[model samples]
Target: MSFARNFIGLGGLLSLAAQAQGAYTIQDTYDATNFFDGFEFFNYPDPTLGFVQYVDAVTANATGLAGYANDGIYLGVDYETQNPAAGRASVRLVSKQSYTRGLIITDIAHMPAPVCGSWPAFWTVGPNWPHSGEIDIIEGVNLQDSTSVTLHTASGCSFSQDSWSPQDCGTPGDGSQGCGASTDNTQTFGAGFNEIGGGVYALQWTSDALRVFFFPRGSVPADIDAGNPDPSTWGNPTASFSGGNCDIDSNFANHQIIFDTTFCGVWAGRVFGDDPTCAAKATSCEEYVGNNPADFQDVYWLVNYVKVFGEDGGFKRSIAKPFNA
Candidate 1:
């Protein structure tokens, strides 16, 4: 309960048109006063089949599961039960509005611990999914050393990055292991991320490629902290996905931001037994996660704010009392 809350209704719209000039203007800001106003809770079943009980915003707020925490937006889960039938209680959120091409940056204060059976992600996806494209800005499964930036697209899409693997951004079920890259910086995600008080994760979507950048808490760029992000001056990106044979524009459109944490899903569950440390915990991913509720107390996201910049940005018109007169 050490957080602030505001009941102010959502107001205004900001121009977020993309420009080729590389200069971006402030389009929108989702901070403590308006974080929940900007994004909506996703109570739908887990698409990745993770052991999770996604709850509505009403339930979230009422149950102390999602709310403000220490000046940041905190999304947490249930850790008191010893194997509930409905799965671990958690929260999933998606932006109310969608975007096509632009700069999305978020300042996070804490992320879920990189413990066994835990999967957390902050990403964006096109309205049509694979047909449009999916960008994994911050994502990793169970005990991963670091998060990975991946781009999943329809058939015939791939990128050129030094450390990326498989070189195939194919659609789902193509036997291709996704096209993405990861860094050795453990501080970029999980336990290491929370140690330094989290950091900033930014994604730039353009007609040619989708790129991701990470700036640890103290190393954040002056331009970004100033609300004027210039990726050009931010140096080389952490990961960049430029399509070789794919039409980036036609393949990706109207993307909505997302944040979620699931347990023992497709990735985490499938590889559970393969990990020596995790495997030693239990016979299966479900067994470990279901029995150990106390281990997940640190499973949460505390975000300071999320900002969007565009070629020509302007603030949304604020309204008061609905002006029925």
Candidate 2:
């Protein structure tokens, strides 16, 4: 349980003033050995009821669906199984700890490619589904080269056109499509992401707003590498979700981080008709995924580290208090 405390001073008065505003301090880190300990394998049926089998840690390790590799966490899907009955076997993990407000930074070395019938995501969700809200930080389906960030909540949440697709953060039946922001950079997702050797993804959640930023491998800031991240100095985020219409505090709470890769269920299956490339492969997402086992050979996640930070240098180490109040 060693902590890295490296604070940079900006000269006398300014440094003191900066401290008054609050600074990000490292709270918890999950890597290789510790990463598996921090998260629990999700063996239950997928919430979306996707055509996939979520295996436990024992099965994951035995089947080579999950393990440690190159000093990082490796989570992959079954590539050897041919046309199976249930579905393609995969791994889904959810953090045992939950956070209310903090900065979550994930450094990934590789991610699953945007192959047909494949859907991968690194996101967070609170207890009780739509009532507590869900944040789709990195999510895309089929052959999408760019990542799409979305926020889903109950009624009465809305956002301006700040993102690429500014939709209401409310239920679809309520006339809102949910707040969605698609990244313009191709290197931010899929095969392009792995081509650049992956990178760091930082998500800052506060009472005011939720911001997400992506820094490609070579471009990651030195401060992050030093374990002294300062989001203020990181410049504009790739996606910013904030406005007077949305009540940030009420809409989001006690969210647990999650990582999973599933074959076409709701999103990918529903939109299978739209993707020409994917549609040409098979009549449906499940059909394509069930038959073409080799297509997902490169589908996996290689994570270097996941670090959590709190504001004002206030971080609690107790597992009981996963988040700072």
What TM-score should be assigned to candidate 2?
Answer: 0.88
Q: List per-prediction Cα lDDT, in the order shown.
A: 0.78, 0.79
Those runs of model 1 whose alpha carbons end farther than 4 Å from true positions after fitting are 1-22, 161-166, 171-176, 312-325
lDDT of 1 by residue, 77-102 (tens): 88888997888999988876677787
Judge candidate 1 at residue 148 and give its lDDT.
85
Model 2, C-alpha of 277: deviation from truth (Å): 1.3
lDDT of 1: 0.78
> Could you tell me every candidate's TM-score relative to the true structure?
0.88, 0.88
